[model samples]
Target: MYSGIGDHGERAAFLDARALIGCRHRLLLDSTHPRVLTGVSEDAGVQQRREAAAAHRMLVRDTLVAADPERWLVIAPEQTAAQRAAETMAAMEAGIERIWGGLLPQELDTGRRGGCEILRRDPDRGGYVPIIVVNHKVTDPRQPDPADFHPLTTELYTWNPKPDKHVRNRPQPRDQQRLAHLYRMLQRHGYASPALVGGAIGYHFDRVLLHDLGPILDDYDRRYADRIAVVRGELPTVPSKVPECRQCPWWSRAPEEGGQSCEQWLVGRRDISLVAPGSRAEVLRRHGVETIDDLAAWEGDDPDDWQYEPFTEAIVTARAWATGAPLVRRVDRVQVTRADVEVDVDLESYQEHGAYLWGTLLDGVYRGFVTWDPLPTRDEGRSFAEFWSWLMEIRAQAAADGKTFAAYCYSRTAEDKWLYESARRFAGMPGIPTEREIQRFVDSPQWVDMFQAVSEQFICPNGKGLKKIAPVAGFSWRDPEAGGEASMSWYRLAVAYEGGEPDLSQRTRILEYNEDDVLATQVLRDWMTDRADAEVPAISDFGRRSIAE
Candidate 1:
């Protein structure tokens, strides 16, 4: 099984654990068009995440080694994969308790080569189990359960384990499948642990989150097999529009060998995937409706035959796309909730660290409640409290004067999440409101989500994002490069998260970006109220069909 084990050599970095979780077309590109993938550089956000994850792995390794100095062996990065694998084998044979940064022998049969963050020697099984340390949370604090874990030792409490673990109800398929990949490699090298389980040390290094590999083995096998097929040209790589396309390296780059970019290829063919959900698009393709033109021109009455219901919206969107229209009004007359006193609000955070800035616009004047301190700081509460208190005061004053009052945000998801989170985290802090008060404010009709309003009354052919829709309302940001992703990079620089002199200019840029965001919501609400009827085309004008339930 180990013959020519390292012949696959160093596997491309792109084909790592993410290949199983990310877009398959990207995997194919990584194998065949590696030059194209390499041409694309990592953005600031991606860089920040990579750094944070690396830092987390180091911390976990250090903690484990500190606890049991004699038992832990760390494989040096300077060695070749074969040398590291041999060293790892010797350590395992010698019965080392834990191995850090140990590269496993390649699974040449599948062209898989990689290393685990830590290979924990299973005392009962006589082999090592893989453990990955990541920056993101694996468990949900919101849904607490009896967790079974060894906090300081970073081991799983298997038998008679305490039921104190709170597993995230949401599936973390990426992490699970990754463990399966490593498990397969271990098996190939005759290092397979009898216990078909792996662990992940997430942001809350309080305990290792254990996962049984049995359930995900079949799934991982299928995904890996299919990806290998595509890589070997046994299967074709078909490009389809997906949410991941937004971050895909090949999304816009034209191949040096002369071929249309992924974006160009999709748009040129007027691919149905561009205008419809992936599942719906696949169903549409099976029904001989492969392109947006086919979808727009399709006149079939019973969409039930296509095996996907409620297909009217996609058809309408395709028609709008064909007509070069940004949006089509669903309602005969667009309406917006108006108030004598109103505030447009926007929040900015530094990549899950915490919300650091709350920008609000009222009466054409912008007031920014900002924390200059780095995030995950107690000062986040100060900024949030200041913003909330000021807004509440405005509402109270408006009520005292018998004037209607409302607060508008582009989307309530991000804002509402942070609001409740801040209240809960800073419960006892001065100026912080109770969770109930935050809920009351969010639940109230006066808290308007303009994005929801837009969704209810319009069919945006392009997209419904603030940046995408705001231009239609005659609103634009002062900074040419202003965007949510761009702001992540700016925030990193502004705060100097990677250790450097903080760039004050980036702070100014972030403030301007936030101001524009609030201003966009204000203008959008105004546009929907005053000019939507005249400016936006009615859905009825586009040969509207009956929508199925």
Candidate 2:
């Protein structure tokens, strides 16, 4: 029925719960997948506990039953992994301390297990005939194979709870081919249209699917030996860290933090993926270079090879890491014009979309972020116009005062990319910065990218990310994890501005994060200016200001 899992930190043979729920490809791929970060997040951890608690209350009692032999089974005789996980937690507010499920090999081999949480059986007979798989994820769970059920069963249904406004129901992907393969079709039914989870409770009846159980039984048998070996700690997994590891639960808990920062380890990882999709980072790894150092060390040995360009790029990346500076190969003294009047900008946005708010620091005075009431998905509303007009007016005044206008930001990639995107998106909006104007503003000498400036001079560990480097620049954040990602989460928690009324608490946090970002640049700028000491390059490409001509 299933593999066995012993109690807390106990070693015993067990099958992973996912192997039962996953498609065949996902099963095989995940089995061999590295332990590094793969799509795990703190928010997701919170949501799972919330959903599991809600689901636990929904399915635990004498729930429902129907005689259709396809849909309803109120009470299940077996406890599922989801239930056990929920029970083991101190409370939903408290985190899921750990994941616990599956049976010992003897009980597991009894042919009654899966990722599903509940198991129901026919009244006249015994054993599990239908499984109600409870998934806490917002998306609907995929349908299971008929063979995974007991020979005595006759039906199965996926029971999931989600946060949809109920405009659409989650369940009812009949998937007849998968259902047909089960070979117990009283009829082919997809139930494709989802009505509502709330409506489902009214129709529960007692019936079960006793489909072909042979394949799953064989699957269990095939996996038993390997399962035992894993329990015995005979298998060691080397993690290949990906971008997802930045927020992964496992990475947070793992003893070793081996990641991109480790050049030697990073360059050697190459894992092919299919069912478990790989980020395919191996394209760079395939070039026979692993770390940034390796790339930097290439002395034009393979001039004719295709890896040259990537190698060249890697040298810059490695040197930047080594020195925390940008443009390592360039010997030019990195300098930008200093003036009495300075403008520093930071934008906050939903990463899935364009900027919602743009904040600026003016002459060391915080001017505040500009955003419209009821944030638009892509429109450059009045607030953007207001912000731009003021910026232009300031630029004019600074020029009139015989002082250069040095506009600043920490990183160009996000702030630079977003401003142009917003400009292009709102090109048709009257009084808004046109796409051309946005480009002109970006190219102007006023726009100084501190990130690029620092990278040219410093090699830093933990990468040259602003949060890490900001402290060195004598800047600090009041919030624990103030980042672009954190701000997005804050945006969700923050109330939207309504009819000129702002949500102060949410607005405050957003502003705080933005201010810290802008100030980090200020610190960096002051440092670079002070460091210039005897010589400052008369001209800098920080922003060419060809537009000023």
Candidate 3:
């Protein structure tokens, strides 16, 4: 059991007990059930990641045991070997040493100094650099900095699900802001060693860090002094209308069964985000307005005021929340092109890898193209090609028959972004469409973004995401924990080829998730069409192929 331990897997930088209080305090404080930290879900994706973490820890422990079998006798005598391995890895993952120095690794001498989980000794800098492992590709990295981390750190290490694939070398601007602070802190502390970043793409090492520790580190000290307040929760914990709030654990159901929800306490406080993100919410708050009723009292029927739309939405949402009903505002109708035969599309992608699955619904059946191989390969291109050909063929058939056809995606920006990016990466592939074709298709009236469509017509109270909109439209996912985050976890499991080949059940869950995503769009379309002045019925022929109920 010990000799054949597998490699430690890639997980998010913060996923333990310490991080809950340190970096993510706002979310944790809002959580009604603290047990969410340890509750195990039956979600296939969650289970897959849990398995990966355990396997990776076992591998690391095996390596430690193999190196010095007798070392643990002195290092951890009271606990069994298994207990020591698990606890140590947990400590390493959480950077507990920065807080408590008791459980430092005895065998690894040069590592785990100055706050970073030691990757290795830095030959160039003479001191160690901190390492951070993220679950996805380094694209659009958004993380709060650890102010308590050691100042001697240089470039932090980061890797994704497909570590072997180097999607891009540049860290995001926000990350650069963080690295700048870390570098400056080290210099200010008189460590003065140049910081660098390196990570493994399989066995291959890439000097992936781009920010120069020298120029950027100059102002880190002054900035970091100010930085502590931003993360320290100096600002009031008021709920905003941001998308992240919709998925925050604070709003999640109680961690334990049959307990109160984290969001239950704030039942009457209205979301100030209805107006917008900036000065508008402040204005509303200043007027002693904390609920939709306040907005109604202050509102006037001024033709020129931009607040009209917001006021209208607040009223509708307020009534629905109070009465346990759904309300659709009729004044704000949007013009969305519709056809008898329409394609409902949804794309499932991992930031580390390009779009891997494209699920489409047409002719009353769900047609999906799943790319199993890693990115920058022909595997993803095949999915694009297969979907495009079938879509164009049916579209031509509809054109000849004098019937209209169109494509409707829940979020236009998401689907269009993936389509264009995939075209750019796999331009030379035979099955894929050209960038020009994709651009033309996007511009065409046949392509509809349901998000924009919904926003133009009605203002939803809860959120505008498919998870909220689809349920109201009478669509539900076939599987539990059928969220984007959960799907990514499932994807990792679906593609696992190391310990054992993936079985049918693993792949089936992923397919079902994608299929459900596309079907939800169909439901939304039909609902909207029904609400339109003239009804256009969507296809009733949900194809023969269906996800297991």
Candidate 4:
């Protein structure tokens, strides 16, 4: 579901487990429509993640096999679906302790067929259950009393047996939902364990995450029914703009290129979803505000007493989108925090790996501290320490000159996370700041998040991302394809992430991208301070104009 995957050249013969978690429009397209490859290619970050997950699964399988070779039945990828199912069934019938990479028998009634990462026989319940191995981290040591299971044995424990393991507050809903789907498939084949539970082995492969299947199955049933309804024409298969559109194969090029893209279709209709999310668009449609033009022309007064607090904000955003304005002011006067000695900062990293590049812009000069080594290496600390030292020197010099100082980033969340993380990870290293020092700097007024300022002071119709908003400030990256995703792709080539000869030119490309990012932040901050009040239309202007109309 997350990957937007389906069979090519055929109407969906079966709904996979992913169908329980992803976009409905995507599912419908994948089910009913022939595949159309577009400009949306998988970025290096996604490819790296997929490879990492595959590696983790192999490591776990190897570890299990090394411990007890006889108790495991490993299904070969070379086997056809029929062959896999037969082999899996034979293993289950023989009470094999574990079946690695098993393809479950298809359920003819529901048309659901999929492969399971691991199918473990239950000693207590007399049948098999599903266990998934994933790349993402499932839990952290933030809270107590997490549901834990033995990584190798698949024995579950409600409380954490280890002190440094806890359940994350945020749930992994996709993992749970997929497990529920697989559990139903197991039940159909009459091989489901009566225990009503499933397991997930995440990036931290030391333990398995145990999930109770009771509530998860209930939710899965509802989602599966809805998807099946949409497939059977019991529901509308209307396309809406969603975050998932980025990964969808059915999504095509711009409408002006004579391509039949979902985005182009929405643009032609001036669809509400073009300016608002799917849920919000549905709400506006219910109120008879069906298009961006209609929304822009709407008065603040609600005829039906909907009491929607965001009604005026939505209308203003629509107006901005319709008029092709970068932003419409949500406040009376634009306010931006500025300083005499200002620095714009940007960091580049490869996926969830350590930050390898720290680019800074100060006094019309760009400086970059970068490491060429592949990530998750000791060398990351050297670059991080050098960047920190340089930044501190600038800050101290400014203080000595009696100049007020401020460091700016488009978004502080990423920078702040890496700042503390780097400090902690390399505490004993030369020139590395302590966590306390990092916290003091982050908490001080000198650290400013320009993204927060923009979000608070303006209504950005398109997006609040630096790439989107920086252009409004007359700033553009030299690289036409400059973006975080593009930078990750460049970083991979620059560092030889997958064991090939490194492309040194890609390193130059990444530095240029990082420089542009920091420059964009600086440009955006300057625009907010010097020109935003005179240039952007305020909310009051809309109100007065509406009264005149």
Quick one: best TM-score, which candidate? Answer: 1
Model 1 lDDT tens row, 120-175 = 87777668788888788776554543454422123432322233344442357889
Cα lDDT of candidate 1 equals 0.80
Residues 207-257 of candidate 2: C-alpha lDDT, one tens digit per residue: 222223334434434454444344334554344555444544443343235
lDDT against the true structure, each candidate: 0.80, 0.46, 0.52, 0.79
Candidates' RMSD to native: 4.1, 14.6, 12.2, 4.3
Per-residue accuracy of model 3 over 454-513 as CA lDDT, tens digit each? 777665656678888888767888897788877776666677644466555767998888
Off by over 4 Å in 3: 1-174, 192-248, 253-261, 268-283, 300-327, 330-335, 373-377, 532-549
TM-scores of the models, in the order given: 0.90, 0.48, 0.61, 0.88
Error of 1 at 148 (Å): 16
Clashing pairs in 4: 1-18
Q: Candidate 2, residue 452: CA error in Å?
A: 3.6
- Over all chains combined, what TM-score does candidate 3 have? 0.61
For model 3, the local distance difference test gives 0.52
The runs of at least 3 residues in candidate 2 whose Cα sits more than 4 Å from the true structure, single-residue gaps closed, are 1-41, 44-237, 255-332, 352-354, 377-380, 416-430, 455-461, 496-503, 532-549
lDDT of 2: 0.46
